[model samples]
Each structure stands twice: as structure tokens, then as C-alpha cells.
Target: MNDLVERFEVAFNQIHQHLKEFNGYPKNDNFVELLQRSKLKHSVIRVHFDLLKQYAKLRNALVHERIRDDYYIATPHLEVVESLEHIKQTLDQPPEALEFATHPVIFFKDTSLLTEIMTAFDQQGVSQFPIYSKDNEFLGLLTNDGIVRWIARSVDNNVVNLAGVTAKDVLQDGLNPSIEFLSSHGTVYELEERFERSLEEERKLKAVILTESGKANDAPLGIVTTWDLIKVDRRNEDE
Candidate 1:
């Protein structure tokens, strides 16, 4: 059986390593606190924090749970180990999904209410969104997590109260959401290098929006995610 403690250690170490990649401060006396200083995109930073908290909880379970074969108690440990490897590889993998989810890409009009966006997010497990105008003009990208940060900061920013502030205001104002372009055609390895290099400077590693043109202002044809890549990797490993 896979040792949960060791697996947890690996999980924490991987998370820590990825965090360092995204956290761009000069240096820090403590590592965990370093994330607070990440210069990455607002939404990417938020994803990092959420991932961190989840791994911490998994680590706690690994440390506290007792394993037994009699009742198949080891399954959870194996599952977690699988998940740990999955998450680590997703963040650390090369660009694009090896076999990304064909889950129909979700979006909202620039003029629509946040509730519509909220509904899309809730339904599709929206990791991020590519904002678009009425003419299908690419506005900017936004992550569901970015919305939470916007809410938290809007009170202090005072932009929330402005009546005329449009979706473009909430989007293009300053909440730099990370974005990636789908390769018109190329090796995923080539894309991975770019993605990793992008994160090396800060936390905002924009996702590669798979599209027909893979060119600017082109309509998005599909989506890919780190999680999708990780799952593909795990499946490959099993095979």
C-alpha cells in the first residue's frame, strides 16, 4: 500500500515548489507567507490559495488516519495519493491538455448580469472565463475565483458603488486575470515551457484558450486546463 504520510509529504512539497514558482517577492523568511506577496494575476493567486488550503486538509487526513486492509481503509490513501500526483502534475505539466475535458466552454455577454456569470460558473465548474462583447469581441479573461477577490476588494476600491461601471469596468479595470492562447498547431511540450516560464515570474499563468485561429481576437473554439492535463497524465501512468 502507498504510505499516506510519505504521499502527503510529496503533496506538500510539490505545492510548496509550485508556490515558489508563482510567488515573485525578493525573498521571504517564511515560505507559506510568501504566497501573500505573489505578483501573479489576481485569479491565479486565488487558485493557488485554494489549492494550498485543500492540500493542507489532505495532509491533515494523511497524518491522522489509520490504515487497515481489513476494511479497505487504504483506498482513501490511494485516492489522495492519486489526487496529489494529479494536482502537482497539473500545475507543473507542459502546456495544454493531453486530453482536456470537452465540457462545452461557458461564457457570458459583457452586458449580462453577474448572476448569469455566477450561474455559468456554478454549473460548468468554471475555472476561468474569456469575457466577450456583443460583437463577440474579446474583452478580457476573468476567473470565477477573481469574482470573489473583486467582491472582497470592491468595498475598499469604491468601484463597486459606481452606477455606470460596466462589466468592462469590473473586467478591464485592473484585476489582471491570467490567459493563455491555444496553439494553432504545435507540440504540447513547446506550450508547457511557455506556461511554466510565465509562472516563474509570478502566479498568473494564463490558461491556453484552444481556438481555431489561435490568433488574437479570434473566437474561442474550446478550453484546456491544468487539471485536465493532470488527469491525462494519471491515465497514461496507469496505462
Candidate 2:
């Protein structure tokens, strides 16, 4: 009872502090106002606003009214405490974790000429390229490193038909391009878990490609790289 109340208060205060830090507002702002402002900035909070408001009322009751000496009037139910904890965790997550990617992704067809591919790479400054088949099936990724390796092998073999060679011809066996497909609505936690699992399995994950339905054949909506996750984490820490 008392312990649950204390935990609830702690969680509530944590949420309050997070809101203050995020909004860069004075502590003089009321909790409800801060929450309302947060809803405007975070879609997660907007989705859970009603429940949070109810929890705020409960917290107030637990803290304000006293039924006996040295005891508060209300003891928060276990469910309320759990809800507060969940909200706190959600709020603690960085905004980038929930942000949807919108950057343009450069891709190529496996049959595309190596000359054309290099031209696109030079013009776009893209290092990673998702290669697909003519029917729009995802074949594999064509990274700059892969291109360099293929060029070295071609030079060793005294082959000079670089313009005539296709991306499929230069495809190296056993390079093991690491890519994953995720839905546009997929959560950041899901993205993090996939990356973590790949690391645990000692597999190099290069990109997490987002699609409408998380299918390989679907057109990519966005892409996430290891660097993107690192940047997001760093930004969260700075905030």
C-alpha cells in the first residue's frame, strides 16, 4: 500500500522531470499543463493522454488528502502504479526512437551496368545500394566495399570490360550482405532488438529497410543504418 504509493509518486515525479527537461520549461508549470504540452510534441503521449490524466488525478489524491496521522488518505492500486511505471518508461525513450525515417534511399537493379551504378554512386554520394531483380525482387545489397573488391579481382584477372560488366556479374559470393525488412509502423524497440540479435549472432547488419508491409518485394519507405541508431542515441543523451 504505502510502498505502492511511494513508487507511484516516484514514477510520476520522474515523468514530470522528463517533461521539464524535454520542454525546457520552468518547474513552476503544473503537471497537467506539462503533460498537455508534451502531447503536442509526442505522439505516444497523445495516444495515452486520457489514461495519464486519470493517473495524475489519482496521484494528487494519494498525496494531498490524509485519513490518519503520518499516513496519506489514498493508497494507489497496483494497476495504477504499474501504469505509472509504464508511462515513465515510455516517456524516457528518445524522440528519435519513435521518429519515422523520411530520407531518400538509392537502389539499383542487379542487371544495371557497373558503369551506370558507379555514376549513380558518384552523383548521389551513396555508399550502400539495394540491388533488385527485374521483377522487383530484392537480390542483395551492393556496397562500395563490394565494388572495390570486385574491381580488384577484375584487375587481377586482366579483365578490362568494366562498362560491359553488370552488377550481377560483380556480385561476390559469401560477402553476406546484412539487411532486414521492417514495416513502416514498426517500433524503435523492434529495430533495436533486431540489431542486438544480429550482434549477438555475430552477423553484420548493414541496414534496416522499411517497407509498407515488411516484405522484401515491397518498395522501401525508408532505411536505418548503424550510424543512424548511434546518432539517435547520442542526441538523446545530449538532450
Candidate 3:
């Protein structure tokens, strides 16, 4: 009784410290918001707080209720942290670097000449391009905006080469259509919200590519787009 209570306190203090360490942006939020909020912006701190509360609860149960001091009680909670760490790792990694889009990107030779634009549109893939060079080297990315801009500028200028456009020319960088995936198998209201937001926001795809489990060069197994995210999750909603 007393032992469990004391252990819970110590564990809670650790939890508090960990949660507070976030600097209160999504002050108490877990890596989920940590991934989304773009460096712990304070407005969403309550979300983090909610996650920490849950994390603390599980941690207490695992440390105090489940495991005896003699036996290291490593159950789902420890695994939860590890799982969250993995989620953080995957979230921390840029989506482009993942090589998991359902579509392959088309590329041109360089930045100067508008020889051509490669597209997966023929294949019916995501609008973003993960470009490569003729030499098979990684090159800058092209976005729908970049393509549109190039089309708009083609009349006035001839700088439609691959080098002419880069990920810098488009893409919000830290901002893209994404949602956090939990390894433990779960779904949440927030996931739906992110998808809805992605749908409502322009300059990006209606689908939030969920990169959960797959090997290198893996395409997205499941995607939640605006339609599926909102009301039309079936035949009408497969964005």
C-alpha cells in the first residue's frame, strides 16, 4: 500500500518533470502534439497535458501496481514509451526522406532548362514529387505550387528546369499533411481532426499520408484524407 503510493509519487514527479520539460507549449502533450505543433507552441499545451496524464496513469500502474521491486515490471507502459519514442522518431523524420509515397516522382535533368516535368499523375499518386537526377542522385523536390508557378511563369520566363524549382520553391517544410501513428493499435478523435484540417487547408493534398509500419521504399498502406476524415469514409470519401 504505502510502497505503491510512494512509488507512484516518485513516478509522478518524474512524469511532472518530463511533462513540464516541454516548456508548456503543448506543455503537457506527448510526442503526438510534439510532432504536430512544430516545436511545442503553447496554444496546444492542454493536449500534451492530457497525453501526459494518460502516460502518467499507465506508468504508475506498471511501476507501482504491476511490478514488484524484486521483479522489474516492464509491461505495456514501458513499451508505450518505446512505442512513443518510435513514433517520435518516425514523426521527426521528414516524409520525403521516408520514401513511402504511393507514387514515384518525376524529375528533370537540372535547374536551368525546362526539358520536361516528371509526374506520377499518370499513375494517380500524390501531387508532391520526390525528385531524382538523371544520374540517379537525389535532387530537390517539386510541389504542386511549384508546378503551377512554373506553368504560370512559362509564358514570361524560360527558367522551367528542374533546378529552377526546388522544395524551397514550395512546401511549408515543417508543415505538411501528416498525422501521428501509434504502434500499439489505436485510433483517436485528434487523428480525425488533423485530417479535416488538411482537407480544409489549401495548397496540399486532401489526404494525410499515415506512415506507420513498412520497410524502406514502402508506400503508404493506409491514408486518411479529408473525405474519409470527415463524413465520407467509404466509397465517396477515399481521398
List model 3 lDDT by residue over 4-31, tens digit each.
4444445445434433443344544553
Model 3, clash count?
Answer: 11
Candidate 1: tens digits of C-alpha lDDT, residues 70-153: 322223456666766765675565334324544456656677666667667788766677788888877777776767777777
Error of 3 at 94 (Å): 16
Candidate 2 lDDT over residue span 1-239, tens digit each: 78897899899999888778656777567888888876655545566778789888888887777676568877888987897787788667534332645366778887899889998889988787888889999888888888887777667457656767888886644453789988877776567656766877899898888887889998877888777776545443343
- TM-score: the better of candidates 2 and 3: 2
Better of 1 and 2 by TM-score: 2
Each candidate's clash count: 4, 0, 11
- Per-model TM-score versus the true fold: 0.51, 0.62, 0.34
List per-prediction Cα lDDT, in the order shown: 0.59, 0.75, 0.40
Give candidate 1's error at residue 180 in angstroms: 1.8
Ranked candidates, highest TM-score first: 2, 1, 3
List residue ranges in candidate 3 displaced over 4 A. 17-48, 51-119, 135-137, 156-239
